[model samples]
Target: MIRDVAVLALEGSHAFELGVFCEVFGIDRSDDALPGYDFALVSATGDSVSTRHGFDVRTPHGLERLSSADLICVPAYDLRVRQPDRLAHELRAAAERGARVLSICTGAFLLGEAGLLDGRRCTTHWRYTDELARRHPRARVESDVLYVDQDPIITGAGTAAGVDTCLHVVRREHGSAVANTIARRMVAAPHREGGQRQYRERPQPREGTGSLAPVLGWIEANLDQNLTVEAMARHAHLSPRTFARRFQQEAGTTPLQWLTGQRVLLAQHHLETTDDPITAIARCTGLGTVDNLRHHFVRRLGITPQGYRRAFRAPHNK
Candidate 1:
């Protein structure tokens, strides 16, 4: 459903965030049987824009291009710079006309300038979250989440989270298969829940850093088994309460939450690649029954297990 895409190229834009939009929407991946978006880099200020890295990117398109866009993406720009009034007006108009708008990192400030963030739940980079909240007191700015999909206005936390947010919009509009294909070509994770924490500041604690790396591997390898926090605690050689605290400190998520996410991911893989029945897939993923699987699938993914299979199953299987 989201074929037409436009990215606003403001002065001092972060190249990586711009590249994220370009990689997800600009590239022609039709050869791989993926949908090719009608994409444009629209200059919000002028034809020539200077990036934060001290380079110039000249775009032929302008604010008028946003008129036809199904989705308009705003990449992070220098937070200190002010957005042009004309650009803000155009963005507000586009949203008013039912176009979905997405902001990556500090770009949420532009949405705030357009009065779009008022009374809306939104977010920006973790480093800028407090500032964003302070500036727009009416906006419910969640600091920790990867992204917030508030319908018609999605806001990503920071640089890499933009990929997660864009893929989510694609999956919502076009189906998981198309989103997955794009993600594969980009060598990125196909899905990361919006509720997941944006691990800021600290390097993610990993195998060599006293993390539950082996326990995580074991859990993934045995998703079919009924994984319990107490069981995982025993495996990690710690009391349940201590293990829970350590897991949160090291993994940025609770043990049970991570286990459910892994099982759901496994179920998604099976749904996409195999013709296994729902009941069989459910059992294999430790979801217990088809009903239980459907409940979690719908809760986490916003689609039924059968619907996900139908949308993402191999062509031959279909």
Candidate 2:
């Protein structure tokens, strides 16, 4: 149903991410027996724009093109710089009229600035995750995933994750068969699980002062263990009260909350990648029972465990 797409290119945009938009949607793929998308690169001022890569490109279409698009993509931007308020307003208007809005990498910061990401789930580059969370307290930031597809508004993690997000859109709009055909032509993987972790070479604890590294590493390894705030505090060699406060300050969440989140992540992985039943997954993740797991899963993900498995299970398994 998404036949028309418009990508917003601003001054100082990352050329590579913008090119990802063009490569995935701009090219005429009809010859490859794929349904072609009507794609346009539009600018705020309808003039030639210089990319961060030192190249220039012209766009005749202006903000008006965004209004007619079924989907709009805002690729990476330099968040340290200022974005025009008028362009943000136009992007918000398009979203208000039901256009699907997507952002890649630091593009999520632009969406946050436009007030579109408020109270929604989103993720940007992991390095900027803290800043995004600080700026938009309403957004539920999930830093680990390759992307977060919250329906009408979707966001991807750092650079290369953009490809996964775009392919996901293609899959949702045209079905896996068509998306796979395009991927084959592009010589890219047909699908990459969006929930996969954004790779970090060495993820350090929040502050370099003292590490919460040992506690976090222990929690991850013992996901099947019943981890409570009191237990975790003892493990970290702090009193329950001090540990609860420090954990919130350092990890941005309480010990129990973080533990529960980790368990859910583990459960999700098994649901998507394994043939295990919901009951088995519940037990494996220490969620105890299927009903309990379903309750927590739905509360966190807005989808039941079974529904998630059905949507993302490998094709052969399906």
Cα lDDT listed for each candidate: 0.87, 0.83
lDDT of 1 by residue, 1-318 (tens): 678999999998999999999998999888887778899999965488999999999888978899999999999999777768888899999999999999999999999988899999998989999999988899999988999988889999899999999998887766667787788888987877788889834455677746778888888888898788999889888899999988887767788888888888888888988888889999999988999899889988878998888776767666
The superposed Cα distance between candidate 2 and the true structure at residue 48, in angstroms, equals 1.6
lDDT of 1: 0.87
Q: Which candidate's lDDT is highest?
A: 1
What TM-score, to 2 decimals, does candidate 1 have? 0.90
Off by over 4 Å in 2: 200-318
In candidate 2, what are the lDDT values of residues 125-232, reduced to their tens digit?
899999999999999999888889887999998888898899888866655566777788778766655666677433425534566778888888988888888888
RMSD of 1: 2.3
Task: Output the worst ten-in-a-row residue range by lDDT, candidate 1.
Answer: 200-209
Q: Which parts of model 1 have CA positions greater than 4 angstroms off? A: 174-181, 200-202
Q: What is the C-alpha RMSD of each candidate to the true structure, in Å?
A: 2.3, 8.1
